[model samples]
Target chain A: MRCPETDNQELLVAYGAGRLGSRETAKLEAHLAECEACRVACAAQATVWKALDGWEAEPLASDFDARLLARIASEEQPGWRRRWREWLRAVAARPAVPAFAALFMVVAGFWLLPRGAPPEPRADAALVREIEIIEATLDDLEMVKELSGGDRGEGARSL
Target chain B: MKTGVQQTVVGVAALEHDAQLMLRVREGDQASFGLLLEKYRAPVVHFLYRMVQNQAVAEELAQEVFLRVYRSRTSYEPAARFTTWLFRIATHLALNWLRDGKHERLQERLDEEGEGQTVRRDVPDRRPSAEQILLKRVRRDEIRAAIAALPAKQRAAVLMHKYQEMDYAQIAGALGCSESAVKSLLFRAYETLRARLRRLA
Candidate 1:
């Protein structure tokens, strides 16, 4: 029989834990009888297991359940402010929300502008043409006044 | 018939019951959540206490574990045993706490409290002599120190293996590792413990 320590160490652990079946236990016992090293290893593991068994956990605090339930209740009924903040955070986490917001802003800007507002260059050209037209009209009025001024000049002189 | 198979069947049935309760919680059944909490609260606290070696921190972490369970109830699936999922949450929190190096200062406080609690708990019924109590305390301290000295993963593996009585597969599920890795961890951990505590036998 091979040494369990080398071939199958988990067997030693299971054996020490009393988890091995009767057949495997008998087999390991035979190996332990012939092998001093396996014997030492098994004994040591069993001792370690026993020492661990002595380390019992302390009793839980009596108010553990009460405290946990209270926390859960508080979580379930967070203040409106906190809920609002959480809602904002959840909204902020989604890529689509911000993207949609930006697109909406762009669309809104286009929609809110005056329908008849002209382009900047076209408005500048129109203003220049109006100024030229006013200048040309003023020249025509000056020419008419000159053409009628000689007779009026003579009449005023006579008066 | 194998005992392992029998235990697996039993474990599955128990987990199925827990899953049913959790499903009810998903549907807003507060009473079902309470039932699950009442059933698992002690084991979770005890496991965390053993892992962190501090009572206060263990209780705090246990609260977080349950809170997470409740918060995630909406997505609860019965793909795995509830114990596996619960312990996985627990083991993750404990490992994080240890990794953060928060346990160093608390260990001294634990030393002070742990001795008193152990003595008080033992004194009630058995009424062992003073010398015997002192001896037992010494042995218990040695065991705890030996376990604490192990690497965090190894410590978790050994605790689940020995105290929690979890088989390797369950431990692997909780630890998020393969069964072979868990076996290796236990092998190394037990080897270290035996070296430190062999004289106690």
Candidate 2:
């Protein structure tokens, strides 16, 4: 059949394979009614396919199962350590893993690391001075408290 | 591990046994995982061998495909046929491997020491003479190169259709597209192959 402009060689191949539905089949049949060249071409293609049916499938190679089974066995780990080892191997194989680990470390450092002492020497000195000033002020207040009311005598305090 | 008795797979027994093995795989049984590989290795390797045109690469990729299934075993749901899922994973890895360019494939091959095994495999030579074998190899190589040169989706569609005998619907699932898309992809693939291999005919 003379295929339409939209109907290209693929349809011809599909039609040759008997894959077209009834409507398409009817259209092809009607087209073939008028067109001899396409009909011949289709016949030739179909014949080639029929001839190909005599061709046997290539035999699968030996050791295919043994090798594949060995691979699958290696993946199914016997324990957590083996699984972790596999993960390390996989990560080492791909460049993406170390980058991901680095990013993970960065993110974890920002979020989870302990909030501890400031590191600057000036800040440390300031903190020590601040503690001393606060201590002096507390001493003055305690002296005032002693003068105002509470027991101050060493013997009474001890008792 | 099961000792001393790997069962031979045949007929409907082979098909039914695949599902049973898949069930064991889901429950973390290593022997069942081995059985799945034992049963499907040839067809799977053949499929990849045709797709990639490099027998050694195909063999390595075939192993990776099964290993992928084993690793994903915990998430394996028996909603569909195991072979279907297996092939879908195979198609996905192949296409993605292609898409990821040359870099992703470095690790998925035989080690440098085993590169000796990658020497050109001798296909069955039924041709008349050594010269005829050379000519046939040239022709087969050309056809394979043409098929591989096809756009990834179309090449995959052609492979699934030709070797796996998957209908359009199954291909749609495997390729993650609609059935009509599968049809269109296959149609395009066939057209490409016909154009490339026309001289060989």
Write the residue-wise lDDT of candidate 1 on B1-201 in tens digits. 559989866755667788889978999999999999999998899889889988899999999999999999999987777888999999999999999989986776666877757433434765888899789989988987898899999998898888778999989999999999999999988888888997798
Candidate closest to the true structure, highest TM-score? 1
**What lDDT tens digits, residue by residue, belong to model 2 across residues B20-115?**
787677887878876677678877877776666566767778878877887787777666677678888888877766777752355355355466
Cα deviation at B8, candidate 2, in Å, is 29
lDDT scores in order: 0.87, 0.70
What's the lDDT for residue A31 in model 2? 82
Q: Return the clash pairs for model 2, or none.
A: none
Would you estimate the TM-scores of all the predictions? 0.69, 0.57
By lDDT, who's the top model here? 1
User: Best candidate per DockQ, number?
Assistant: 1
**Regions of candidate 1 where Cα sits further than 4 Å from its true position:** A1-7, A81-159, B1-15, B108-126
RMSD of each: 22.5, 22.7
Error of 1 at A124 (Å): 99
* Prediction 1 TM-score vs. true: 0.69
